[model samples]
Target: MAKIILNRENLFHNLNLISKQAKGIEKVAIVLKDNAYGHGLLEIAKLASEYGIKKAVVRTHEEALKINNFFEDVLILADVENSTYSHTFHIAVNSLEQIKKLPINTKVHLKIDSGMHRNGINKKQLKEAIIGICEQNLKFTGLFTHYRCADELSTDFYWQRSNFEQIKQEVKSTCEKLSIPTPKFHSANSSALFRVKDFDEDFARVGIATYGYLETDTIFNNPKLKPVMSFWAQKISTREIKKGQRIGYGGSYFAKKDMTVSTYDVGYGDGFLRLNEKHKYITPKGYKILGRVSMDNLSINSQDEEVCIFDDVRQLAKIHDTITYEIITTLNPNIKKEII
Candidate 1:
């Protein structure tokens, strides 16, 4: 079976960098959505907690419940529960309608669609949202907005930041007029946090950077972060292929000369990307993958009992024309993860 190994030292190193950029560890909220981006929720949560992290961000209330014991604050990005509110859980109010659905006395962070216009309420609806939050008896604790292209070299980031600043001021004034406590403001993710020279936020909702993959453009002087996860697979069987013999489903690969090959127990079925023979994928150790990747295995020219599928996914993501987030998050959660 394929397995995942997490580097504890690398994780701590990344967190240290994030903490420095965030101005302090207290200002960092590790994003644990989608099973810690498929690095194993419980596994990463334990490590984060051990590293003195106090806050976490997840996609659902259900995910928060699993790691509540690991953090002082758990922010649910997109789910609300009717159950009694706990100080440990804070839901993000994406819409006025969502505010109405939240239980009375539930703590929430208002998400403003400053410019991304994806989730969150529009900036124009600020007063309406405040009124709803007050009327609904929800506790407004924070306000945040997502950047659309903070990683790219574009002026859009500045444009969005300017918009969020306006929204923040409006929120503060409206809260003051309504006699509501001033809510904390945060507008940076991993990329945006690094883009700015000054780090001033209640919390930076850091995701990929915490796991050691910064996606900023090379033109920017991005910090060098170490990858925390490595994937490995065990050899299931081995055989010798004679010269001129074909291999795999469509016979897309044939040995020019005799060579020893082994099928490794890792494939798309286990959330790994399947490669066709035309691409000629090779392992980090320089062993060539011999044929089309199978549903449960792939033949590689190696006899080692265990082979490293990837220690870092950036190159693999480039080969597949996808992002590192997709590459890591697509990994099957069922795979065992060990912190080294």
Candidate 2:
């Protein structure tokens, strides 16, 4: 079995800590989208529910259909095209057809296309559309938009935040004046979760922030969070190569001098994302990657010609210019992953 490890204990701590910063909040709709960012969908969802996180946000209907029973409520957090599960939990409406297809009694959160310009209803368009939804007689509706640079505390982000606020205020006023149930007012993701100063909101769809790494380098040193996904691998075997010897596929690795290479059962297929050959993967105690990361295995530089490859998810993530999100989430579940 392929060796992969996970740390769930630290994860709970990260969630509780991040929640404290959100001033006024009753529900923490933990973002379970992207298969819980590849941290194992069912497991993390259940864990969240166990830890008191009732609501979860999923990308498509398939993800929602997986563990709807475990969480308190599910929100199709994206504009999923498939209408097969229209009767399922609330969905985020990005277009008119989606809004039109929503169940008569279905509750949905409106996605306002703010300055982000990615996938939301424009401010004016938002106001009109939401009003139309109510007029058309849909179930329940809440308004929410995504923040593009909520993590980057720079001038560019300032503009985005400004526009976001204006839209938020307008939506709030409309919801209040027209009694439209004003969306939960969630314009923040992980980016806005920690760095947006005092973004007091009714609810926050916490995702990567809840998983550990903010997925952004906004804050470092004494940061108020801890990494939750920790991986472990074991050294299967070791060998000594003479000078001028070659290693791995295509003889990409050559020993200028006598060298010892440790082999591991990890490769790009395992979500290694083999970038240039000189990438790294970790061993149980913390041995870095060495040589080419092949489709089925990789080598590590070890001094004693003897090494241990237990598991270390972070080390692998570091190789691909990523955190646990990309690495662990991309990991093939077919491989053996045990939670520690």
Candidate 3:
């Protein structure tokens, strides 16, 4: 079976950098959604807790429940639970309709659409949403927006930030007039955090950057965010092939010269990308993947007992013409993962 090696040192290092950028460890809310971006939910959560991370953000309420003990505050980006409410869990209210459905006394974070338009209520509905929260006796505790182009090279990020700033002022005034407590406001993501010359948000929800990957343009001079997870596969078998011998499905690869090749216990079924002939990928150690990637295995030009498939996903992402998030998050959750 394949395995994942998580570098504890790198994880801590990334967190340290993020903490400083956020101004303090308490202000850095680790985004643990999607099983910690497929680095393993509980695994990353445990490490974050060890490193003094007090807050977390997840996509679902159930995920928050899984790591409730790891952080002081768990913010659910979506979904809601009406049966019970705890101060530990804060649900993001994406729309006015969602605000109406939350249970009484539920801690809610009103997500302002600002500009993303993917989720959250529009600025026009901000006052109405707050009134709905108050009417339902829900606890309004946070005001946040997502930066759609924060990771891209565009002026849209500034526009979005300006929109959020205005939204914050309106929210403050309305909340004060209605005797509603001031909600914690945050909008910067990983890219936005680095883009800001001065870190001043209540807290930043950091994800990819915390996992040792950043997709910003060259202008940011991104920090040294070391990749925390390295995917490895054990050698299932090895063979000496003659020159011109084809390998794997459809015999897509033909040996130019006689060489040793080994099959590794990982493939698309394990959430490893099914790389084809055109997108040649070489391992960090210089082993080349040969032939078509199979569902349960792949052939590599190496004889090592265990091979590091990838330590940094950015290199792999380039081959796939995708982002590092997809490369890492697509990893099989059932694969054995251990902290190094």
The residue pairs that clash in candidate 1, if any, are: none
Better model by lDDT: candidate 1 vs candidate 2: 1
Q: Put down candidate 2 lDDT per residue, 1-340, tens digits, no spaces.
A: 3554456777778767766766533457788777677677877887777777767788888888887887656788765454545444777777766777664666777787766788867776876777667865775446777777665546666676677778778777777888756666676777666765676766778887776666555453224566655433455678888999888778777778887777766677877567576654456656656667788777777643334443335555666666666765776666665577
The residue ranges of model 2 lying beyond 4 angstroms of the native Cα positions read 23-25, 79-88, 176-179, 217-222, 234-238, 256-260, 278-288, 301-324
Candidate 3, residue 59: Cα displacement in angstroms equals 1.0
lDDT ranking, best first = 3, 1, 2
Candidate 2 — what's its lDDT?
A: 0.68
Q: Each model's RMSD to truth, in Å?
A: 1.1, 3.4, 1.0
What are the per-residue Cα lDDT tens digits for candidate 1 across 36-88? Answer: 99999999999999999999999998898899899999999978566775688
Clash number for candidate 1: 0
lDDT of 3 by residue, 1-340 (tens): 6899999999999999999888899899999999999999999999999999999999987898899989999999867566675679899988888877777888988898989889889988889999999999999999999999998889999999999999999998998899879999999889999989888879999999999999998777799999999999999999999999999999999999999999999999999999967988999899999999999999999999999999998878988999999999998889998999
Best by lDDT: 3
What is the lDDT for 75 in model 3?
92
lDDT of 1 at 272: 86
- What's the distance in Å from true for residue 198, model 3? 0.9
